[model samples]
Target: MRIDRTALTDLAQGAAFLGSGGGGDPYYSLLLGQAELARVESFELVPLDSLGDDALVVPCGWIGAPTVSVEKLPSGLEALAGLKRLERELGRPIDAVLPIEIGGGNGLAPLVSAARLGVPVVDADGMGRAFPESQMAIFNIRGLSACPSVLTAACGALTVIETDDNLTHERIARGLSVALGGIAHMVEYPLTGREAKDHAIGGSVSAAIAIGAAVRRAREGGDDPFAALYAALRDTSLYPYAGELFDGKIVDLERETQGGFSVGRVVIEGFGGSGRMELVFQNENLIARRDGDVVAMVPDLITVMDRETADSITTERLKYGQRVKIVGAAAPAMLREARALALVGPGAFGFTDAYRPIEALNGWDQG
Candidate 1:
């Protein structure tokens, strides 16, 4: 299978939806992917069945805060640097560049790396949506290790983490990210095409393009983009429920800016007996609760959007009186398994109960 120009938008949009409210903006990644596509010509659909068991596949992504990616901008050398470093350490040529997670800026960064490195991009990815930590990838459930992982912060801070366990890698990377000023650039978890096919979210890159296309068509037709998005996602059967529609004004936003990550939360007051909602975010909205009850949690997509426009608002860009809609959607079934749940469910982020599928929590009435 080959990804054409029209398919790129579908991938980007689906990724944004899957990003579950914190994968960074898809527009930037789309532009980046488009540029790379123009240079590379076309992306080959490397199916999982095509590779041998030991085909070398490396996951690539931008590590810092999404806000930093917008302001500071990557010179584009950092990912290549990390890729080269990892290849040297492993003493093998990386056969393909795999997307770490779909959504946000990280999704497109790998395309550039693939084009520059002249390697194919595996059709699958570690996470279907953007995840905050490095070790949250489904690969962990498959018993694959994160270390021997290589991290390269854009500012010339390079480190090779050799952890005995996946949890340790997440801990160490989080600290390093904090020390790096809240965000860093990294490439890790070298795997093979066969392993990638078995472990990663299958066809996620292609799915991103398909979702982006559906949204683009809606826009072109001058129709409702959100409704069109909902229709497109039906192809995936991911979100089975929608969360409460909260009308709130941002009363307070406390952010800790460091190492490129702006970790913070936005407090909002319910309108006309609607109650209150607090959104906790670390680069992405992780948990949301109303009246002290968890309404949405990780492994599911919780997005804060302009109530009217439906456009996403970044954690750092949120401000006072910005009317927003808090949306909760069910996570992908591939990620909803017991193993995946343990890593990304409500408890993984310190919430109490296991994350209930959005469909189970709420009716599927997104029309």
Candidate 2:
């Protein structure tokens, strides 16, 4: 399938929701995707099964604090340079590319690369939702090596990483992002088509597009956009359950770019005399609580969105006193497995709580 300019906004909107209040601002990447479409007409997206067993499939995205993207503009050269270098190292041309994470602006970065590099982007990704660290990617959770990765900066510098350990790769990459002025593009988890088909979350790219388009169409028809969004997510195999977790005004927010990440928390006061919902985030919203009761946690998707327009308000873009609704959705089943949870669950972020499904926590399934 081909992604055209007409579907760009929907993709951005859906991707923003999938980001769960992280993934950087969708505006910058949407603009970049638009510009690329203007030159190439449409970006090619091949199905995961279409790839041959030996085909080289690389996953790529930006890493570091989302705050940095607001001030530092990407030159659009990072991914291209990094992809070329990867090809040289592998001694094989890239058969296709996919987003390392399909949340926020990272989802669209691969389309820009595919358009420029003449390779199709697979309809899959390593992270079903955005994660703060490299080790959180399903690639690492599935025992895939993160080595032979390429990190590229906007200033034209490039570094190749090779290590037997994924956690070490994350530390080195995080350090480099800090040293490189807080953000850079990364092409990691070099996978053969067979490995990608076996591990990567399938149909996520199309799922994001569908969610966005559903919201847009609903808004245009004067229907409830959130209803459309929830319905769209339920229709997808990856994110099967969706609902609003809380509705309120942003009463408090604390955020900082620390250790190459945007770390912060937000407090939302419910309308009238209702209690508050608090969300702690590391790039992506990790854990959420309502009236001190644990309502949602990591691996599950949590998003703060504009109440009226249903626009996603990412972590870096959040502000005090913004009227918003907090939403939650169950993560893909693959990410909820025992193996995946050990790496991406609350404990992965140093939380002591055991992982709980968003649907179960909220009793969404009972009704």
Candidate 3:
């Protein structure tokens, strides 16, 4: 499928929702994608099954605090430079590129690289949604090695990491992001077509596009965008359940750029002095509490959006006095499995509460 400007816009909208208040904001990414679309007609997306078994697929994305990414723009050569270096390192041409995560800016990030490399983007990603750390990717959760990964910054600096330990790879990459001014493009977990087909989260690209389209149409038709968003999410097999978690205004926010990540929390008070919702984050939203009760947790999708417009407000974008609606969606089923939970569940982030389905906790299942 070819991704044009319309699809790209919808993609940004949809990706922000899927990002679960992480993956950085999609606004800048949309601008970057639009700029590229003006030069090229469209971006080509190829299915995983279309590639040869031996085809080399590189997962590409921007790595850094979303807060920093908004201020420090890319030099437009980061992705291409990284991919070119990886090609040199492997002594082989890459057949395609894919998003490391199909949420926020990362979802559209690989397009420029693919265009420069003259390669197509695989219709899949390592993480179905954005996670703060590289080790949280499904590629790592599935036991894939992240070593031999390449990191590139806007300043023309490049580093190739070769580690048997994925966690250490994340540590090294995080440090590099901090060193490089809090943002860099990465091409990691180079995969064979076979491995991509078997382990990578598939169809997330198209799903994002579809979800965006649904919301756009609802807005144009003067329908309820939040309802449209929930309906659209429920229609997809990837996100099984979706609903509103809270409707309120931001009362307070505590955020800081720490260790290369935007870490903090936001407090939202209900409109009629009803209650409050608090969300904690580290690049991406980790958990949400309503009136001091755990209503949603990680590995499940949680996003805060404009109450009237349905535009997702990422962690870095939350501001006091903004009327917002917190939306929650189920993560891809694969990420909810026992083994997957060990890596992404609330416990993984130091929360004592065990993983629980968003639907179950919010009465969405009964609804």
Best by lDDT: 2
Q: TM-score for each prediction? A: 0.87, 0.99, 0.99
Q: Which is better, 1 or 3, measured by lDDT?
A: 3
Candidate 3 local lDDT, 76-167, one digit each (tens): 88998899999999999999999999989899888878988999999898888999999999999999998799999989999999999999
Global lDDT of model 1: 0.72
Error of 2 at 91 (Å): 0.5
Query: Against the true structure, candidate 2 has what lDDT?
Result: 0.93
**Model 2 poorest 10 in a row by lDDT:** 2-11
lDDT of 1 at 281: 81
The total of clashing pairs for model 1 equals 25
Off by over 4 Å in 3: none
Better of 2 and 3 by lDDT: 2
lDDT of each model, Cα atoms only?
Answer: 0.72, 0.93, 0.92
